[model samples]
Target: MKINAFADVSLRALLVLSSAPAGELLTTQNIADAVGTPYHHVSKAIVRLRELGLIDVERGRKGGSRLSQAGHKATVGQLLRELDTRSDPAECHSSHGDCPLIIECGLRGALARAREAFYRELDGVVVSSLPSFRQMAPVFQTIGLRPGM
Candidate 1:
């Protein structure tokens, strides 16, 4: 199942924040650049993540975000569930009209089950453990942070 762009950006931003050293925070723009996403997209992702209590944001000229303690323990599945707001993977209704097969579509249930299965598979994976610091050297470097410095 394909995730939405917001979910993708949220995951990327979280991964970037997880790679930072303790006490090191990254601004929305920095995260956007690191993830190769537009600043506005990353900004929205940051706001959602902050609302979910996944990242802590400090407000000020020097303000930035860092992975929160909850973020470290959050599972990929949990984060995705929070980020992906769609109840149905396939939109049955559109400006034109409802899908012709909306009444008897078996694809909907199948897709929903598949999406749940996908989330189950990732439930064991902690967000912070997605990549090791050594493995994230390049990602950190992309954000102008030297790993292990």
Candidate 2:
């Protein structure tokens, strides 16, 4: 299954915020730079996260974005579900009745079960359990977050 870039960015954003100091507000540009995504895309993802009550945005010079609550209680599954995006690996046309062999296709069932297992694994992971950004400094640098930014 291929998850969208939005899911990647959302996860990164949450993980970054989880490592940041409590109540520290990070700008959209900051997040964009950290996630190696466009500013507008990060902004849109932030809006979605806000709508889902996963984040709170503060507007102004001293304002930015922060997690609505601690990361300990936030599961990766919650973020993925709130994104409402799909990561389906197979193009089973059973929904549109386009595939004549869908009824007998073992591939479809296997893919579906695999997808469920993928989400189940994700569900078991909590944001707080992830290594801190400081610990992943090399990764952040590789993703374009300049040192000390």
Candidate 3:
């Protein structure tokens, strides 16, 4: 049940954005640095997040990104489901060829149910509440923002 790297980076970007002061917009590089991820990966995550309405981005010299109203209220399950773009929980086709069981396998159904259950367990978990401001302040400070800023 491992999520993909893109989904992981998107979550990390959200966590960093959620820690910022209200209305504060953070540059993609700043977020990348804060999360210890590469700038390009964070940039791609930011674009997808904005497309999904989870974050807002402005384009200009002073422009950056911030959590949208939707972002603040987003559940971990919701975002993960959206970010994890796999059509099937398991791939029936491999380099060897399609599985003979693909036509009649009950495993796919079971796996789908299991994946949904995993998401349901996280439905009550809000992304913004993952780490408190105090917990994130030190990381933000390393990126040049003040503790409460």
**TM-scores of all predicted structures:** 0.91, 0.76, 0.94
Order the numbered candidates by lDDT, best leading. Answer: 3, 1, 2
**Regions more than 4 Å wrong, model 2:** 70-72, 87-89, 94-97, 136-149
Assess candidate 1 and give its lDDT.
0.86
Best by lDDT: 3
Residue range 50-120, candidate 1, lDDT tens digits? 99999999989999999999998989898888878887788877789889999989999998899999999
* Cα lDDT, all candidates: 0.86, 0.72, 0.89
Segments in model 3 whose C-alpha atoms lie over 4 Å from true places: 147-149
Which prediction has more favorable TM-score, 1 or 3?
Answer: 3
Per-residue lDDT over 31-100 for candidate 2, one digit per residue giving the tens place of the 0 to 100 score: 7777678999898888887887777889989888887864446888767766645444466544666667
Clashing pairs in 1: none
TM-score of 1: 0.91
Deviation in angstroms for 115 in model 3? Answer: 0.2
Q: What C-alpha lDDT, on a 0 to 100 scale, does residue 8 get in candidate 3? A: 94
- Flag the better candidate by TM-score, 2 or 3: 3
